[model samples]
Target: MPIPATAPARNTKSDTDPDALSVLNHVFGLPGFRGAQEEIVRHVTGGGNCLVLMPTGGGKSLCYQLPSLLRKGCGIVVSPLIALMRDQVAGLLEAGVKAAVLNSTLSYEEASAVEARLLAGDLDLLYVAPERLLTPRCLNLLGRADVALFAIDEAHCVSQWGHDFRPEYIGLSVIAERFPDVPRIALTAPADDLTRKEIVDRLGLNNAPSFVASFDRPNIRYEIVDKQNAQSQLKAFIAERHAGDAGIVYCLSRAKVEDTAAALNKSGVEALPYHAGLDAGTRARNQDRFINEDGIVIVATVAFGMGIDKPDVRFVAHLDLPKSIEAYYQETGRAGRDGKPSSAWMAYGLSDIVQQRRMIDESTGAEAFKRVSIGKLDALVSLAETANCRRSRLLGYFGETPAAAKCGNCDNCLSPPLVRDGKVAAQKLLSCAYRTGQRFGAMHLIDILVGRLTERVTQFRHDKLSVFGIGADLNEKQWRGVIRQLVAMGHLAPDSEAFGALKLTETARGVLKGETEVMLREQVAGARIRSVRTKSRRGDIAPQIAGSGGAANPGLVGALRAWRSGVARTRGVPAYVVLHDATIDGIATSRPTTLAGLRNIPGIGDKKLEHYGDELIALVKAAG
Candidate 1:
């Protein structure tokens, strides 16, 4: 009943070479290729080029990793983050692959040694920073070595349209010109149609087949709460649903990151702040602690992103809005990497829209760039405001054709909001903007419409307008919601040159002329009841930790997790790298007591089985 050592990584490999299966079972211990992984791996291994858009935790690494081992020469992985490189190389080494990293962190001796290894064909994989990889010395060294393929990790950064664009990634196009024969692959977690085109054009992967895995992470429940008291809402959500679980909290500014981390810590949540303002050492320490230590939350800005392989992150909470949907997806996709249920919860409000628009318009970017940014922001805002299924809209933005209108996972799908016809309200708001000469922001315009005769209103003689007191039926908050929804729906826009003035778009003319109808959802009060099926219901995540999950883990999983934690701590690797939660799930459920039983479990390759087989067997026997 044991899985064959030659079992193919995926059954779709009906025509795949058997050696891929051998390397999969003997080296990686995975059952088979997931999604389009088999096709991608085979294509690249057989000397083809590809651009892969797989979601985070969808095993993007394996697409390149398997081929790296199977091909005749070393694989060159151009990555942008140090933490990412470190995690990949470490995980590969644990799997018995000859992996190394060449970064600024290494001393001359270490660099020389790794260079020697590469020249000697001793490494199966080498991760290099984009800046370092593009250097004359590094490129020359690579030109001399036999490279089986070029794996461009985080390939979305090459796109100028993306949120995480890097200038150095542009130079990566040289790979095609230099190693025309070697296979090349570019992969990223999130990219819209435009960004995809940018990656394709900039990276010179024109002829490469694109293997886009489903962007849907069904395990992740998307919750975008109307931002009222975001800090309190965030605290309550954490306390109620994800207490003691490892999570990431993203804010929009350095000051906010520090403040939020301070607040969370003051409230007894173990939290740390991460921003570019922090010293390199502090950032490194905080990041390391957040990764190695369990149940710690890291409040970070965009600077701390692009994943560090801490797979058990249960939630990704956004205290402020990201710039675009690509940014949002990239940040939230960091959660639930291990295929367990997770939450991508966000708190946004009217001010977030104002702030984002101001940033885009006030930026020094070209007119085209600003237009694209505004369009992307508007799409994100639409996602936030829609009464329909959030998942469908989100996936739709990425050009994913939704199979169903409702995903049964997002807050809206679970608890559909009450809708009200806001046609009259929209007319009044747009008329007020027009009557006010479209020269004021939401606050001043609201004051004019609601008839709160302030000094500015009196000075502008806005009290004399016929639209005055027309919206008195709605409170300031309700009116703000209306305006927010209007902006989100593209009925109005911020006047960038006027420094926080309101502007009516052409769409506003339709509303003002009664040519278009409007409906808006009642604003969400707070976080909805946390849903999405995951391991927490069983209290199985690191059993000893308090408030970590529900009741108790039925004996064996707890003991093995405790053991795995100790091993990971001693070995200084992320706990999942030692034995993934899935592998532990397999062992605890199967209760394997023999070497064959252990070997039969996925994630236990020859190297891992040899290293931990006896101990696992003994543990299973004692538990029995």
Candidate 2:
């Protein structure tokens, strides 16, 4: 290969200029930019530094990728995972962009060749992990190369206690001191206020402009149900609505991940297990199968995050509650990446609360860190117990003011849970906890409340207390709800030393004294399955959208998808890497019959058109 000369150092032209627009149209195959993308691209291409907090699948890549192509030399992207780098490079290659990854996956000679190409200015983009990017050899190579920009993707990893915390990411701040002239952009999805500040201070991006997009992902429907036979519930959920669809099941522990995967497989669902405990080879193979094949569900711990490049995940079901609202948001946001309707369902229960709180209480971290963790857990609990729209409160947690009080996409807004005054119920529960020496869990406490003389209750001789049988007005299930709500409200907490025993917080005193009023969602019998209908933004009832991009014709969607799958198999890449679901939906709806017709659709750039245009057109014509 010949050495390519570098162009000008900076292009101050607007992103909508003819050259930028042409590149967007002919190279990337998108007619226009999404929110804040064009402005961020223009600013970075003009040699400015910035920070971006856009939701997942909100086109965060284009903010830096476009500037990389339009400016002087190759753009260096700081990716957090090797899988993400590989997926990104694969997608870029299919779009006719020269991209490469330098990670553990590459041999010594391959990495050296990539370095040589970078120095020769023969590449448009380079994705490197933070550990490798911070190395002396890699830093020196970057110094010798004609670099156009530096993009810190998943920038929130710099936070000390973030869900995706990586110690190596802190070293990335050195980039600002070493490469001062190169315009840098740091991007993350749905970061909280604390994480935002940490990214600025730790990455040395305080001086950069911050572009915060709406945290709302309108394509996803959020639902939280009380946990009841969790494995069976998950099975029924998949069977009723998401049958044969690709979804993720999250477990809080590695053992649970393995168990869930095994259970799902036994239940006739194709599933795989992913966690840190697995060998690297097995993990890699499982991840590859999940990505390259269709209709495969991966039950995983947090280990399978940020690296998922699949765009057609129909749902993300949590078998347990997440530790914090931020963690929950990031995990659930992985669904509906292609702008089609999807589901974020979670099974939350009293044990989840106890387990999460116990973990925080038992952790050996400093008191300050534990305090922050507790606060985060409290916020997530509030979200789970809220009677209002889940989206409204979820967005509010990240400091985004939603446009409406009700999102109409979540379970609460759809059914509108009945809120009843639970002040008396809360007082009774708190009083019972106090009278019983606060040495029992919710289950044992419930037995006493509903006047049940179980073996343990008889052993404890607790049936003689005044508070016993005081809660008979409410059934056992409703009393359980009241106790759960009390714990959620901080009037009650689980004892770390007593193994699921309940304890009273200082706030419990006020509730017992009738100084505070409590409102809680009334417990009601839930059906085995619910309708999938949802209200769109205009308040019109819209049928459930399936497959990618909500194509009107199910038959055409299936035919187009089969053709795309064959191509993906031939290329040895994920189907989305060949063409995103959005692109498939676009082609299916338009039914393009010619090269020119296909080129007019979004996500079909010049290289994609040249590679698969004729076959796609023929398929569409045949389906017609």
**Model 1 C-alpha lDDT per residue in residues 1-624, reported as the tens digit of each score:** 122345433232324557676777788887666778888888888888989998999999999988887777889999999999998887888887889999999999999999999999888899999888878999899999989789999998888898898888899988888788988999998688888898888878888799989998877888888787999999988988888899999998999999999999998999999999999999999999888878999999988869578888999999888999999998999998887788999999888988888888779999999999988888899899999989899999888987888887778887788899999999999999998898898888889778899999999899999998888998888888898899888888878688777789988888888889899888555435544544332233232221122332358787888898898888888778888877777787777667987888788988888788999888888877
Candidate 2 wrong stretches, greater than 4 Å: 1-16, 527-553
- On TM-score, the candidate that comes out on top is 2
Mark the regions of model 1 whose C-alpha exceeds 4 Å error after superposition: 1-16, 448-465, 523-527, 533-553
TM-score for each candidate, following the candidate numbering: 0.92, 0.95
lDDT of 2 by residue, 1-624 (tens): 111222122354655355666677777888877788888888888889999999887889989998888888899999989889988898888887889998988999999999999998889899999999999999999999999899999998999767778899999999999999998999998777788899999877888899999888888888998887899989988888788888899999999998899999999999999999999999999999889888999999987967577888889999999988888988998887887778899998889999998898889989998998999999999999998889999999988899989887788876677799888888888888888888888988888888999998889899998888888888877877788888898889889999989999998888778888899996355633243434455353322322224454567778888887898898888889988877777777777778988888888887788788888888888887
Q: Check candidate 1 and list the clashing pairs.
A: 9-32, 9-33, 10-32, 440-502
Model 2 worst lDDT window (10 residues): 1-10
Model 1 is weakest, by summed lDDT over 10 consecutive residues, at 540-549
Query: Under the 3 Å rule for N, CA and C atoms, how many clashes does model 2 have?
Result: 0
RMSD of each: 4.4, 3.1
